[model samples]
Target: MIKRYTELADAVEHLLLEKNSEFICYLQPVTSREAALQWLAQYRQQYSDANHVCWAYIIGNTRQPQTQAFSDDGEPSGTAGKPMLHVLTERELGNCLAVVVRYFGGVKLGAGGLVRAYSNAVSQAAGNAELRMISPSVQLSISVSFAFEARLRQLLQQYQAALDDVAYRDNVSMQVSVPQDAEPALREQLINETAGAAVIRQVASHSGV
Candidate 1:
């Protein structure tokens, strides 16, 4: 999965100095397509007079329902947008938007230069930002009798589980976020800890931000 930040990333205002051309790349975190579009609009106004405002965004996880968009902004069709999108896809980055604004210098860069420039801009920006993994988490409600409450709390602490709610009835209901992969292990542990007394059930699963 593509993370928001990279441990070691490089940043530069312009990649090519000889051509007198300048490129500004901005890497922003965006959750939805609307947010991505809004960021594009904001940059459009910020660099209204620039020659090109090319951009791309990846929203969602690696599995499914991932949304992506790109625009060449008057550059050769597919030259700018597709290249930018390629960088995002190849890097496996999601929930992020990258905008590359170029102020055309006197000289013209061929199609190859254009593609390389846009792709490099994004890659460099990604390098400069920190990247982290956001895994899928599930909340499970576990019930235990008051007799086992103290031991249950100790087990929860050992597992680094969070208590969502509690009831003073004969049993206590506690909710905890468990990693998807660790759910089975957690369930087994809980069962063994409670000696089949406490029952653990999944309440919900979601991708955390």
Candidate 2:
């Protein structure tokens, strides 16, 4: 479970020159693979004349990502994208996408040079950008008897949980969002307070409040 992690606060772009070759690095926060690809497409189209567009993305926690990928584009097999991604992981950036567009400057940099160039490009961009922490939350559906409604409400407030929805039926059903770190304690309290009658089912997990 991700209690908290750092992420880019906003989009940033940086330019570097190596042996006259231009490397334009773009950094943006992205929550999903689709969004990463969409942002990459925009950069590709924007820099259509560039020689190569290399990209990498980490869609969840950097320490333990849900998914991540990289593309070298037309660059050497292990030159561009992997090095850029290494820089991002080193900096512990989560939910971020990096795209580097290279414009051939009439000079050929060897594989080693390409790797350093790409890595340095992303590193410099990240150094210049702002980062903020995110405490992810889980969405849950809880069912409890009417007898425990008041107690549950108090617990929710105690844990600073968000009340999303409430439905009164055979039992009182509630939709809630709670901080990942607080969920275990909340669950224990719910069960103990309701004398093991309360039930909780996780619906989804997401970053932010």
Candidate 3:
């Protein structure tokens, strides 16, 4: 299952040297092939003078990936793209892209050196990135007698849940979102506390986000 992911909110830099040449790795989060390619194009435009704008990207879940692509630009065939892709996969990051821009510094690092430099760039970016996880959730709606409003509010607080679309006419009707696993217990508490007077309906199933 795809549970957690690490992504960058903005581009991050990893700088290194190999025989005086400069390799800068820029890591950005992207959700689709189009976005990944757009990142590559934007980098190319921003670094128009760069010697090679090699890139690698995975477009979905790391474990069950949906799409992937890479390009070496003008660098050695397997040096830049393959190495960058390797770093991202090993880090178990999904829905992100990696672009490595090389500036010619009057130095020529051979195939092995290029691989090391490119991989190191991506590794450095990964090391400096911020990681976030998906939280499980459920959506529900509740209707209850006006007299039970304050009481229901207190019960929801127990689960750190809150009513979102509360309305008052004859009684109270509102929407709430809570932790997925807490739904059963929350329901039980409402029914028991109200002596079966509370009406609860689930609007959405458990989801990870």
Candidate 4:
């Protein structure tokens, strides 16, 4: 599954503001549904005086799932939460929490206007903040004779594998991070380049940041 690439934030004026109605959007990084819920609680307390708190979250690294919650605090039901959640899920973002707090003015926006306002708030926040993608990666460790260390390093660089660590001795021990899909090709290239003189080990799988 594809992951979110960056976090962003933006703001827009409410289309039907009577007197100083304000909406504040908060975006944060979250790894699990529990974390997202905790964030929702915290923001609810932090903005206790606001009229409404609406939130949405996408969780999991791959095959992500989505959850959303909202309180009108007196506004019409079904007007605030669903639209905000829609924005998050539509973008296929994961491990993230988005909340919009509203302070109502004397004027009343119809159901349609409420949906537009809440959705617009989240869309603006997502658009302006920075985001990052999380991908699956694997680490490969290799030991090579000193004579072949330079060639190995060059080959790793050519493949754009991140050199995690290196140790120098009679043989060189190097750790490299490669995309999960590319691990087999990397292993073959290393074996061929060192002419079977190198011993390679699969270290561990990691989430690529």
lDDT of each: 0.74, 0.92, 0.81, 0.71
Question: Clash pairs of candidate 3?
Answer: none
Best lDDT among the predictions, by candidate number: 2
Candidate 2: minimum summed lDDT over ten consecutive residues — where? 1-10
Runs in model 4 lying further than 4 Å from the true structure: 1-4, 7-21, 32-34, 60-78, 91-94, 106-110, 133-136, 168-171, 194-198
Per-candidate TM-scores read 0.80, 0.84, 0.69, 0.71
lDDT of 4 by residue, 41-156 (tens): 89889989988877766664324454444455555777777777777766644566778888887777789888888888777766666556655677899899988888888888
In model 3, where do residues sit more than 4 Å from their true spots? 1-4, 58-68, 74-78, 92-95, 104-112, 132-136, 145-151, 180-209
State the lDDT of candidate 3 residue by residue for 1-209, as single tens digits.
23345444456778877777888888888878998888888999999998999999986666667798889998879988998888888986677799888888887778998899999989988888875554446788899998888888888889877567898878899799877767789999999989999899989754345
lDDT for position 35 in model 4: 80
Better of 1 and 4 by lDDT: 1
Across residues 1-209, which tens digit of lDDT does each residue of candidate 2 receive? Answer: 67688888899999999999999999999989999999999999999999999999997778888899999999999999999889889998788999999999999999999999999999999999888888888889999999888888999999989999999999999999998899999999888877788899999988882
Over 1-209, each residue of candidate 1 has an lDDT whose tens digit, in order, gives 22222111222233433267777888777778998899889989999999989998878752342688889999888778888888777776667788899999888888888888888888877666666566666789888887888887877676656677777776787887866666777788778877788788889986653
Ten contiguous residues with the weakest lDDT in model 1? 2-11
By summed lDDT, which 10 consecutive residues of candidate 3 come out lowest?
1-10
**Candidate with maximal TM-score:** 2
Give the Å shift of residue 124 in candidate 4.
1.6
Better of 1 and 4 by TM-score: 1
A best-first ranking of the candidates according to their TM-score comes to 2, 1, 4, 3
